[model samples]
Target: MPTDPLERIVETAFDADVRSCRRPHSGSVAETAVLELENARGDVPRRLVCKRGGASIWTGDAIESAVLRVLEQRSDLPVPGVLASGKIVGERGSARETDPLERWACYEFLEGTNPGPGYATLEPTVRRRLVADAGAHLGRLHGTPGLEFDRVGGLARGENGTDLVLCEPTGWHAVDSDTLREQLPISVPPTGDSGRRPVLTHGDYQPSNLLVDDSGAITAVLDWGNAHVTHAEYALARAEVRFVDSYVGRLSRAERRRLRSLFRAAYARYAPLEAGFDRRAPLEKLRWVAQSGSNYARLLGDSRGRRQLWRQFRRLLE
Candidate 1:
């Protein structure tokens, strides 16, 4: 028996004879709950997860659910099945307003913990295998040839194909334009290449998004809110950074080197390394990095200070 109003929303959505609904503290953008539903006709009930959208960062739940449905129908990727979704109107925010400030979607609960903790204890061989498998999955996503969406039409449907870089205000912001240009060593297009060709991308493909069973095999990849079609190289870069960031602290110096080598090797096997891809090119890399930083600041910053920080961070990275 839950007292929270949101918990009641979960119970009502499932029409589940819910024995209990326990909220889980895992994600930042959405409210997640693990519900135990009782089946009157059978001995065992059902266990499902519910995700309710929050303000600021998670305004795309409806669109994300639609995209996930499309992906599950077309691709063999293991994503959670969407159950139901709608505008949840309630009392909150303003007295003048009739609806709540948030929207929500319910999903079939996935059973498994995050791969981050488990990955730390993995044997060298196992880690290599996981990396290789992840690379393969990424390759398949990137290699989904001829996948197209009507850019103009998608926008109408609230499907933003471009990666949103929010600019926010920060006190500790440093690194000037020249410094940023000097640090990054890669090429950046005026606009992202994703608009040109649309390939499937799990917008955020970090260790936390992957789920592994007791034996350590990745059973499912959750969270499709950020998944969309994008440029292959951009997606690859995102994946590379995620993989590296996840394992960096846990690995020894030698192991870190080996892992990087393995990651690049595995990635290249699927998509040949671009001839002039230079990791040391500060100008290009910094531009992208700066864009990312600015986006973060913008999302978290208030209107008055957001633009200032965004400009400074962008210039510094550029």
Candidate 2:
């Protein structure tokens, strides 16, 4: 049996020989790497992306695998196929409850490149299409059914294994300031989705998570680590920020509005926008601000920095 974590997971999952493994740029919550496997039938090797989660309630191999099954079975969204997944076990194949629970999963590698952080610098036509398509894609995702949960929080498999349940929102811990912590407005859950059923939301819908081909159409929506059950309007409002308004400082007001209009128009085809979005969107913007741990950590000790973020937060409301 392979001892190295990567090789162990891959070999255990796929029964394939790991030729090489390389670390790839991944999200803050999960450690992700790509492995090349020697194909027995052909000289070429197969590639798979493996994700390992630390002891965080927000992510795990089982949670992510469950979410992917929903998208694959219920929706038309292009998500990677889960190859194999399980919790890390001991050399004797027994897992101790005292040990820190580390879970891992491997997925078939999708072909495409991330658009990077240059949303404002892309060619005019390409940027517009990408934004519009992303909006539409999210609209479809929000409209996907089979996501039934009583509370507004992250998702976890139910006792039946087929159903999903809501768990406490731990994703907020990443954004909560060490000083202010949950005291910040960003940490407060939005109440706008009251009386509405929680929808399946891609919590981190942004350029970095999307893979695009030469035509600029989204090839795959990557990263289910942030998948959660939330209000449709709340999800839509948050997506608008991720897709457009997060560029507030870099984009002119008129330009931002134009991009937003394009996105809303496209999204409207699949889902309806709520009348209360104007009030809800700003809160989403504040949430986006606190997404960066390093940035929030810096603000924790710096009153001036906290004030600047508050000012921006207030402006979003205005």
Candidate whose lDDT is highest:
2
Residue 78 in candidate 2, Cα distance off native in Å: 0.9
* Best-fitting candidate, scored by TM-score: 2
lDDT of 2 by residue, 163-221 (tens): 55677755542222234535655343344343144667877788878888766788888
* Residues forming the 10-long window of minimal summed lDDT in candidate 2: 172-181
The total number of steric clashes, by the backbone 3 Å criterion, in model 1 comes to 16
Q: Model 2 Cα displacement at 264 (Å)?
A: 1.4
For every candidate, C-alpha RMSD to the true structure in Å: 8.1, 8.4
Query: Candidate 1 on 125-220: residue-level lDDT in tens?
Result: 767666666776776555544444322111102323212322221211212233344344444332223312335566667777787665555677
Q: Would you list the C-alpha lDDT of every candidate in the order shown?
A: 0.54, 0.66
Q: Which residue pairs collide, candidate 2? A: none
The backbone clash count of each candidate, in order, is 16, 0
